[model samples]
Target: MLRRNLPSLFRFSSSASASKPVNEEKSRSVGRKAVSTALFCLTGGVALSALDDLAIYHGCSSKAMEKASKNQEVVHAIGEPVVKGPWYSASLAVAHKRKSVSCTFPISGPQGSGVLRLKAVRSGDDSWSTFFQSRDFQILILDAVLYVPGNEETQRNVKINIADNIPSPSSQACTRCPETRSPGKQ
Candidate 1:
């Protein structure tokens, strides 16, 4: 019995003092701390990048669109506002040689949104350009016009209506317009 238990005793004794030398243990601990810190920083950077992308996706909100429409120049220049990824687009109509003409708005989104960055760049001798940049930081150009109804200020700013033109008929005038006859007269 004594011989059999001797091996068990040795195993117990080896397990009892597993601590390494003081200096070696301290160095290992410091290395682990460094690794932990680096991992934390990397994770934080990734999270911030994701938040920026999300903020850019929302684009311009209802209020900004209203304000732009109120001003005659902005209204006339206002082209299509696009909702693609992290960019919303609108154009500005400004006189040539104007130092600067642009409208910027704030973006609201899933986490920590930011102000939109708008700018007008000279496209050609005859053309002026405008763009809207999202928080995720991308630029888009205007291609179509968004229409709204009612002249009232209350209704003007509100996006109650949006006009989406139908695609050109396969053949010219192929589709019929709605009947104009009065309900009872018809």
Candidate 2:
């Protein structure tokens, strides 16, 4: 009986020892899974960042286009001003007897107030030579559309105000040249 009991106890301890290796294998598999998941997430994040950078480099990102689509206001033809109330007002007109186009807009927001004036001349070939002006700088644009972002309330309040044609005090100085050449000379 002692001999039989000894063999049974030996079998029990041997089985417990065998299970230790299985437990270790299971823990190793779990660690491998955790590492795999981390690597997959890291690769995906890097790929997404690269795509975003590419989009921005190409001019308009998906995020920016999405925002622009949501906020864009289109003005059709001269004399049709796009007014977004309490936020901005924009108007386009043909000036100098249809030889030039003028686009004017006023911006008001938490940042401050300023006016944007754009002037374009029709070339002999029917193309446009455009100029853009803001408080900070002036630039020439071959062809471009201006976009201003605003909320629904401000857009709703916008209307066609003829007074917008009147230049602001700051702009008056630049637009007027002291009536130098006599009012009827040219």
Candidate 3:
């Protein structure tokens, strides 16, 4: 009787041990699948973020090009007022041999009363060459017109500003140089 019972006991212990390993293996497989899914999601999110940034950069680049192209044209030829900012607006109209720029600003406020400076450069040039500047002698009026001594034959890029003071661009330090130097120096 004892020998018969011993065989049955060994059979039961072996089956229990076998089933335990199978259960543990199933759990490990489930864990591995979860880790893989998480990794995939993280990688996809990063890729989408990079794509969004690239699209934004391209859009901004295109807009900047459009603005530059528009600026290259004579303001008066377009028959529309090009507003520089909330404080000022400008328009261009041809009269005889001169190009007249009509700039309007608010008649009230600290910024309202200032010397209006007009600057221009030849179209398609990065350098602010062909320098033409004039001060609006009449500070009491809401509208001021500046005359550029050129006809429609002369294409230019125009910029307008209203300020109590105008600082020289050369007065600032050159970004190309490591140290600040006099305007005369390279």
Quick one: best TM-score, which candidate?
3
In model 3, pairs of residues that clash are 76-92
- Give the distance in Å from residue 100's predicted Cα in candidate 3 to where it truly belongs: 36
lDDT score, candidate 2, position 71: 29
Ranking by TM-score: 3, 1, 2
What overall lDDT goes with each candidate model?
0.40, 0.41, 0.39
Per-residue alpha-carbon lDDT of candidate 3 for residues 23-81, written as tens digits (9 for 90 to 100): 99999999999999999999998996555433333332233223322431223322234
lDDT per residue (tens digit) for residues 19-94 in model 1: 5456688999999999999999999989965553333333323324433333333233223332222234423323
lDDT of 2 by residue, 121-165 (tens): 443332233211111111222122333345765433322212223
* Candidate 1: stretches off by over 4 Å: 1-20, 60-186
How high is each candidate's TM-score? 0.29, 0.28, 0.31
In candidate 3, stretches whose alpha carbon ends up further than 4 angstroms from where it belongs are: 1-14, 68-186
lDDT of 1 at 124: 30
Give one clash count per candidate, in the order shown.
1, 2, 1
TM-score computed on alpha carbons, candidate 1: 0.29
